[model samples]
Target: MSRLPHRASRRQFLKLGLGAGAVLGLAAAGPDILAFASDVSDFIRGPAVPDVAPTQLSEHVWMIWSKDGFPTPENQGMMSNITFVVSEKGVVMLDPGGSVQIGEMALRMIRTVTDKPVVAIFNSHYHGDHWLGNHAFEDAYGKELPIYAHPLSKREIEGVQGSMWHSMMERWTNQATAGTRIVAPNRTVEHGAELDFGDVTLRVHHYGPAHTPGDIAIQVVEDELTHVGDVAMDRRIANMDDGTYVGTFRFYDELEKNASSRIWVPGHGHPSDQVLAWNRELFEGIYGNCLKAVEDGSTMEEAREMVLADPRVAGKAADTAGFESNIGKYVSIAYLEAEREAF
Candidate 1:
């Protein structure tokens, strides 16, 4: 008897006693069957990540900072910062990294600082990179552990964004994030809700659509620190596809007024009081120029040129991550928003 190939083709079924109709039926169901099989095959846990150690940002807040600004196969999906607040009660986490491996790494780092279990989690937004690590925390702390998010964020995550982010992260990291599951926030948090965790108090602020329709900024009141998530990133151009230039400005104004935080922690970079200021200047340069171009009835290409020439954008171009590659697209988004505002 001849040996069959490792992966037998659909047309090779005749040799296995399958009739032509059976072969056709198999062909019809092949995609779904293969998908299920692939999912089962990929069900194993992702490779373990090395401990990156945590950096203390304040008396109560420490972060496992990812050196890389974006996910890659080499980094294994460790692109977002995992911030945890150690309190007398327990730990409160904000944006638990990006993958199961990263989350496990965060857990290892958290253990280094304190032995307390994670008492709560706050997902900054519906972005998968910021919250997919919820899998590790939930697995460590149990299913009943409350994961919080804005109502809109929770709805979108549980609806479609959860699976969408899981798939995107896998593709982006070349399967480094394989086996990560979609663990949406089980509870909802709204603006102005203050959560007390023993000596540490966290204030939640959501000031309209900025990065997304529901971006949550969590403030550690005692430490004067606020994790702004992707609403305002440091050194990197925030993705404006699901965001608005006008709304982001409004968010900044509202956040500064409401939170009174001195140090702003970002999802992708080092925490500093200047994080929001740096982002604000860059955004103002981009959006301010676009607004001017719209008022002058300039073309999108012309608007892009204006934004590129702005002093705020030009100065940061060399140091900002993905600036050259992403600026054109973001400028276009700003242009459209400017046009809308003009009309």
Candidate 2:
């Protein structure tokens, strides 16, 4: 991989760039300084950070997935999958990881495949885990890269929602997210928009509010590959804290109409048709059970228990860790949405 020009050494990073004032401020913060320093060093050097290698899904498309675990220093907040497409013009990245370090790792992986500069980044939604890595691109290239997201996503990342997410990320990573900053997408993409990157063209589609209000799936026209963000988690029950259950099922129905023989890359987990089918079934079952529970006057807890006990959910939830909790949360959200719709 080609290294960035004028890469600073550790001493130079502290003495020349960061200086004594920043160092003293960090030192005064106590143990947090250690995590902060580690983050800084990773950002500066971008050395061989250990992460999953890119998987070639098609001739022009490659995907790098983070392990299905909570963010930690070891993973550098790589809790989402990143897909990049190589075109004659430059590289187009989709959903670039969670933090600055993770974004750096994604850049390193992209370089391993092609030396083309990243010309554009498309964030799938408003989730911090997907786009906070925008900072890394700016850090590496010494300029702001063009980032695109749905209009609602742009609003969310620029409002209180983005601030709350940033605070949560800092706490979750224990300050390993020190250099990560919220660089919201500068441009807003609408449904049915086509982005041409010379050789490769991406058709952006947002059926409705499924994963998040601004969830946009990017389909590489030549490859027949769709990067469907958290709208479709391959094998696990995706968190619904920011999404609606009914909208997810609708998105799945829309996907099925065109998903035949197409390669689908999820926001997390590996790509597979069977995984997509499983998620559709899971969403359908959750929606049905939530509606039933509401009609039966069941409490949110009751609805959660009932949904978890269902064969379709229980069987799939057992395959992945942390899904039981995710499903539990989803049931609660679903029940609330169902109640609101009933009125």
Reference-based TM-score of each model:
0.89, 0.83
Q: Residue 160 CA error for candidate 2 (Å)?
A: 1.8
Which stretch of 10 consecutive residues in model 2 shows the poorest summed lDDT? Answer: 15-24
> How far in Å is the alpha carbon of 68 misplaced in model 1?
1.4
Candidate 1: list runs displaced more than 4 Å: 1-44
**Model 1 clash tally, residue pairs:** 0
Best by TM-score: 1
Residue-pair clashes per prediction, in order, are 0, 0
lDDT of 2 by residue, 213-270 (tens): 8899888888878888989886767878878877887887777675443788888888
Candidate 1, residues 1-343: lDDT per residue as tens digits?
2333447543343346543222233534577654543433243345678899899999999998878887888889888888999998999899998888888889999999999989999999998999999988888989999999999999989988877777788768766776676788999999999998889989999989999999999999999999999999888888889899899999999989988888999998889999989999999999999999999989999989888888999999999998988999999999999989999
